[model samples]
Target: KTPVATLALAAETLENKHIVEKPDKLATYAGIVKYQSDHLSKQIEKLLRFAHTESGRLHLAKTTVDMHELIRESITHLMPLIQQKNATLQLNLNAAKSCMLADRDYMIIMITNLIENAIKYSKEPVIIITTINTPEHFILSITDNGIGIEKRHIKKLFRKFYRIRNNEEYVAKGFGIGLTIVRKIVSAHTGKIYVESVPAKGSTFTVELPGLK
Candidate 1:
């Protein structure tokens, strides 16, 4: 069932008088209601942003953003998903110059999307996030021990609403717009994104942006 349907069913159960008599069942349904509501809200918000991106009306409120701090915050925000997946996050923030001019909110969304993708697709998620500051560029790389993409699919991964069809029994639930938004955000900041993967091994996504002035 979709999130909306699940939320409706959960809400109806919560309103049942008999549910109040079973505290454990009540709690479980209540949790479902909350989780589904959150999931629906997030999906709606992503769709709205995608519409804005498509219309070319997406605006960025530029500011000085600390990449390390933003990365840490993104990890914190996704801690629940990480723990649920038994994921291990290794942060290698080696960049001496960690600050850059970018839209803070968009950066947060982009970083969160990347990390969340890693966690969702991997069986045993071990994500390594690394940052490097070069003389002319700031590079952020996220590596995941996940079901790696094929070379043919990698090029199309950022296309709007494009999803890879695989034979796996379990597939991640998404509208397939997350990476599209990520790529748009990176492009708005005049950055370049790349991916490297070998089938059955893993994948690495790297975003390169202009160094701090």
Candidate 2:
């Protein structure tokens, strides 16, 4: 209801106002609608699925997905955030192996969350996404030069609603369930995810899912 109302209000505002001359205002409103719509859609779908599933576990529908294309799609969805942070997104999708057997929607969610996670933690973050096919698995790495996770916290990062900072130490605020959902998505595909980081240097998240035969 709120999302639909917001959308209607935005459309009405655009129709009533003359933003044609001010490209900046026009772009900001446009971006707002896009962000709100995307957020509402993702949340609604998750809520619907949760309501439907008896076990509360995410259901999977396997299909052949190209990793390069998936990352590109996720990046497109995150343009507003990317621009807001003045962050440069680098993609290294040159690897020969790019296919994965997974659920497209869930993979997109997983990748989107991971990318957003990286963007928030890093200062003047340069986000690098690399994907390739390995002999036994498809490898996806998201590397960022940001404040790295502490050794103790690294192990508990996947725990639901667990946050890293205690008010003073954390710069950005989050619900802290993004990685939990990402972990669930990877686990559903029987994949492995790991993180390596140094305190001030940066952090890298690596995911390896069994390759399609």
Candidate 3:
């Protein structure tokens, strides 16, 4: 969706003859189009790489990922969902000036899926994203004031096709593969994931990655 929207914006910018007068804006849009094209391509590769029955372990391209920018882009991508749930996002990253030597595409996908999952079941729908950078590890914590998970269910949360439901009807519309992918991505980067929750209260997911050298 982001790729499509960005592509459309690029097209509009190109089609507008008046845009030629603004060379700077035209150049910016052109760069946006290129980036989104690469982004779209990577998404397709991820699907084919992981969606196949014969697929093996994941492969990654290591690069410096700006943690703050990645988180901001993820929140931006989820704007519609946040608005639909009437949610408020409180972000705290003043101390998170951290970077990861990892796959940028995978990081974006993992963060986006995590936040989207939070929005799906949030009771009061207030999400708080915080980050901590220490000598040992860099942590990103997403806290949601949602219908918290049960003790019996927390352990199985990262399993593929795992869905949460108290009864017959499904709680959300999803393939339940999002977290599984996130877990795999984290593992590939030698990171750790933790979940804390209390029924009727809320949940928090914290991902800890080793500090960049």
Highest TM-score against the true fold, candidate = 1
* Alpha-carbon runs more than 4 Å astray in model 1: 8-29
User: Which should have the higher lDDT, number 1 or number 2?
Assistant: 1
Worst 10 residues of 1 by lDDT: 164-173
State the lDDT of candidate 1 residue by residue for 95-207, as single tens digits.
99999999999999999999988888888999999999889999999999888899999989999999876685335777999999999999999999999997766899999
How badly does each model clash, as a count of residue pairs? 0, 0, 1
lDDT of 2 by residue, 1-213 (tens): 356777887887778557745889888778779966876776676545444543667789889998789999999988877887899888888668788799998899889888987887877979999887778988999999878888999999998768787345435544556677788889889999999998878889999998878
Q: Residues 1-213, candidate 3: write the lDDT tens digits.
A: 467787997888788888867889788778778766765664565456458522766678889888888999998877756765788999988554588798888899889888987887875588999999888788999998777899999999988778898563317555567788888889988999999999778899999997777
Q: For model 2, what is the error of residue 168's alpha carbon versus the real structure, in angstroms, after optimal superposition? A: 3.6
Q: What is the number of residue pairs that collide in model 1? A: 0
Listed in order, each prediction's TM-score against the native is 0.89, 0.79, 0.75
- lDDT of each structure? 0.88, 0.81, 0.81
Candidate 3 residue 72 Cα shift, in angstroms, is 0.2
- Pairs that collide, model 1: none
